[model samples]
Target: FRFFRWVWRVTYLTTFGVLGFTAYSIWEARNPADQLEVDQSKKTLVILGTGWGSVSLLKNLDTENYNVIVISPRNYFLFTPLLPSCTTGTIEHRSIMEPIRNILRHKKRAVRFYEAEATKIDYEKKIIYAKDDSDVKGDTMETEVPFDMLVVGVGAENATFGIPGVREHACFLKEVGDAQKIRKQIMDCVETATFKDQSQDEIKRLLHMVVVGGGPTGVEFAGELQDFFQEDLLKWVPQIKDDFHVTLVEALPNVLPMFSKQLIDYTESSFKEEHIEIRTKTMVKNVTDKFIEAEISKPDGTKAIEKIPYGLLVWATGNALRPVVKDLMSQISAQKNARRGLEVNEYLVVNGTENIWAVGDCAVANYAPTAQVAAQEGAFLARLFNTMAKTDAIETEMRELSAKQSSAKAEERTAILNEITERQKQLRRVKQIGPFQYSHQGSLAYIGAEKAVADVSWFSGNIASGGTMTYLFWKSAYLSMCFSTRNRVLVAFDWLKAKFFGRDVSRE
Candidate 1:
């Protein structure tokens, strides 16, 4: 027994030794401490915003060649396409957003991410003035971050058209806060309308929801609001039976100016059938605390003034250039004539600026401010950066080779040098590629529950699908488009839960 015990002890020690040695090997190979070192020699590529464009670029960038620093007020990349669903709790906000840190995992090197808003750009100094909001209240504590190359992906802000009282009285659906506020405000309106002491007129006005703008966002929100009333609210609190109403007002002749004529027609018909009123060609000229003064223009150039009363007003009237962007545009001579956004060249580089790039909604790419375009631009910039890095690497390799070829045979050296020259030329060619081009995958919009319209490229389609099957397709398509599979699963689960059980009405 003693002999067996001795053998067992020896075996255990050997096993432990092997395990320790293996771990040491891994530690040496990985060089954990070395990985943490920020590469100062490499070009510092500082990118603003954690939106679709910036995230895509970061994901595709060759981390080894650049010391990448990402700055944004928010650390997570929001899936904007699924954002409309968040208003009605169809998909939880967290489920749609992918943390920026997780996305940077694709990189070979560590990326420095800062949660801040860029205040100003110093072109001469090659530094950006930014405000870190980690500890501050409403104000931003400022600092400077120097960059060798910069990418401005800061997105646009919602445009309220400077209508009186619109900013204060209406809720704009742009960010997560807006969606959350809208959700809470909706419940508040419902609850206020349900008050026992409230008069019929007060209740009627409170229940009369007004959505200004016939864009996809406004239409989607209107549809979701209608669905909430029909599916959940009516069943749960039948008391507000005839109280709830949804009105969509657009200045244009039709809603969804971007979509096909058939889709717009379908949307109109769908909203009408669901008892949602659509007041097209009605421009809201002035907005009071409780009512909107609109100018209804006739086709023959005649215009009539009308007033619309409402408890809750949702403004989804597209986007305007952000103040910071506009300020930057004004300072630059190249951007002097630019009004909307930063004018960028074919390489996605801001015009008249060397080593500066802009992407997403902040870029005047002549594309809609959609996730698809932003992501595409980001990917393109990533490739551009990668190519630039490759060109640098090739140049370095050629220099080293040239040094070594000093004592070699002239003919052999020339042949080898020629090969290096050819490779450098190829790399340069890749780096010189033109600005980004956007590929349209077509549009998709959810009109209501169990009904959707997709102008997809499949089968050369201008296809508009409605009813239960279309809903399934819509859900599936959106789920697949989610940033991560985990997100997809979570969104799917949310939909299933909503289908099986009604939406949660508690304020919390």
Candidate 2:
């Protein structure tokens, strides 16, 4: 009886402690005293985009050092790794998004945010011209904001490679809106296929889901679609269970060319088990409302054009430069030769220009355009800017000390001279920051049937893993990497909810 009484008391204390902490956090978030007003004396630092790169930089930046202003059409940072899950209702779209305001509130100073699209960047004048593209707008919808330093992280757009009918008929998996559209269309296709008196050929055509590109995005989406079919659609719409099919087409010889050979073999075998057809060495030449014309290469060095009828088509070929990036490149003489993205030096400074830096997909740093690469680039920029701020302070102090030495008395003059020497040494140390170096963490992808694959750096070498254990690792890794506590908690809840209740099939 005494032990039970002690246990109850401990539990009560713990519960109260947690409640108190939560209350304090909410209060602090609501009323942050560190949000300082903009200081005109400080240099203005303007950042673009709210993607992985920009968000990582914002999270680590010393806002007190600069009058920071962030401009992005999106007001939230999205966790891109689990984006595919959003398409099949395994995860909600909101679960993966963290509001930009929520992130800015923790800063030492308040940063200005504008919901607008940057139309042009006047590099010579250091001015950004942006237009308010949102529904709600003020009297002045367009404005120009000048900055002493600029960061371009606008990312990339989907690449159709000039394929006709692709932009009109295919669904993309890049944004939250795209995921929602795909979800609605999936159910729409299924329901339309089930209409009374539908012919067998039409039903087969409506149930066929074709995914272009064998990259991680396409593979993951295909996997999620298969899971949705097996877990929910099969049980709910039993009549079309056998008719459902998913096909992934790639121009390359094999899928997951970036992954290890072992993992690729495993993924192919796993896809086979899941009844997902993978067509390699096949190029999609044309896409129509109901069919895609593809040239399939034969082993005998022959090519045959085949028309594949599909209800839902997802195009994930790769990324292409945004128009804004291309326009900026055209304005700079040095960037004229650059093909893929903005050419940046080791410090990520845009070539042929000072005070401008690029990160993520917009910057060509000889690294694959992955979320991890962008995130590390953002962190590097944060450190670089912090060091630069410190160097500036030290130089200013050195100049002040030198002036004091000339005006002070004999003893005071000696002290001022000594201070000048110390300041100079500090300035030198702060300016010695080396170039940006990316440390490759690893690559991860999830296939169907509760399986995953990973090729991670282990110590000096590399370690490749796959199957159910890797799936658990993948889950834990992504959960830990979520942007905030709110996101992590929400994702955990969604996963649990999906496991227990199955995916929500109510399409809206």
Candidate 3:
């Protein structure tokens, strides 16, 4: 009886403690403390884009050091890892997005943000030309913003490889809008196939979903689609189940090139069990509204042209250079040989420009353009900028002390000299920051049927895992990495909502 009573008491206390802490966290996030005004006398530091790299930098940076201004067409930082789930309504789009204004409000100093696209970057003039391309037109649509220091994190766009009709027909899976479109298209295809007097041939075409690429995005989306088909679509609309099918077309020999070979084999086998067809060694040559033209390589090395019809097509090949990034590269003579993205030095500084630095997918740093790489790069830059600011402050203080020593008494002069010496040592230590170094964490990708694969760095070596346990680990890792307490809570609720109530099947 005594032990049971103690257990109940402990549980009661723990429940209240958690509730109290959660309430406080919510209150604090909603009500930010006073912020210091932006001082124009300080160096103007400008950041572009609200993606992983830029957001990570802002979160770690001491905003009080500089007059900071951020410009991006997007006003929110998107957690892109779970973007595939959005396509099937497993996760809501807004749950993974944290508003830029909310993030800036919690900073120590005031930060300026503009919902405008950076049209042109003038390196010589140290100016960025921005234009507001939102729905509503403002009186002053375009303006020039000058900065003493700039960080480019605008990221990249989808690569089509000059395929005909791809841009017009295929849906991408990058942004929130893309996911919404895919979700709507899935429902549209289902409803259209179930229409009265719909021919069996047309039903088969409308129920077939095609995904191009073997990367994480394509694999994850395919998994989510299969889950939807099994869990919801078949139960809700039975007639189309017989005709429904999904095919993944990859130009590579196999999918998920980033994972271990064992895990790759596991994924392929898992997709087979889920009845998702994988067409490897197949190159898509053309795309139309209803079908795609592909060249399939035979076992004997010959190729055969085939037309694969698809109701909904998703293209997720890889990233490509944005026009803004390309224009900036063209202006720099040193970037003439660069093709993929901007060439950066060891410190991630753009070549041929001292004041400009780049991170994320836009910068060529001999690393894969994953969110992990971008976040790490952003944190490195934050530390670098903070050290630079400290160095400048130390130099200024030394100058003032030296001037004061000249007019001080003999006794005061000794103390002033001692302080100056200490300041000099501090300056040396602050300026000794090392070059940017990337640390590779592992990779994770979700397959269908509540299973995921992980290639994690453990101790001194690697550990590859694939199954239900890895799926739980994946969810926890992503949840803990959310931008704020609010985002994490919302994502948790979204997952539970989908599990208990099933994802909303309504077309949006």
Clashes of each: 3, 0, 0
Model 2 residue 288 CA deviation in Å:
0.5
Q: Compute the lDDT for candidate 3.
A: 0.94
Per-residue lDDT over 1-508 for candidate 1, one digit per residue giving the tens place of the 0 to 100 score: 9999999999999999978875675454335342445687898999999998998898788888889899899989898877877887877888888888777654678899888888888887888998876765555377799999999999999898788888889998888888898888888889998988999988988888999999989988999889988998898789888989999999999998988788789889988899999999999999888888999988899999998889889999988988778877877799998877999987888988887899999999788888889999999998988988887887788888777678678778987778778877777686676767888887888888568877776655556555567767877888778886557767888988888987887665
Q: Which whole-number lDDT from 0 to 100 does residue 36 have in model 3?
A: 99
- Model 1, poorest ten-residue lDDT window? 28-37
Candidate 1 segments exceeding 4 Å error: 1-36, 134-140, 298-301, 409-415, 418-422, 425-435, 458-467
Given candidate 1, what's the lDDT at residue 435? Answer: 61
Better structure of 1 and 3 per lDDT: 3
Worst 10 residues of 3 by lDDT: 499-508
What's the candidate order when arranged by decreasing lDDT?
A: 3, 2, 1
Q: Pick by TM-score: which candidate is best? A: 3
lDDT of each: 0.85, 0.94, 0.94
Clashing pairs in 1: 346-434, 346-435, 347-435
Better of 1 and 2 by TM-score: 2
lDDT of 2: 0.94
Question: Between 2 and 3, whose TM-score is larger?
Answer: 3
TM-score of 2: 0.95
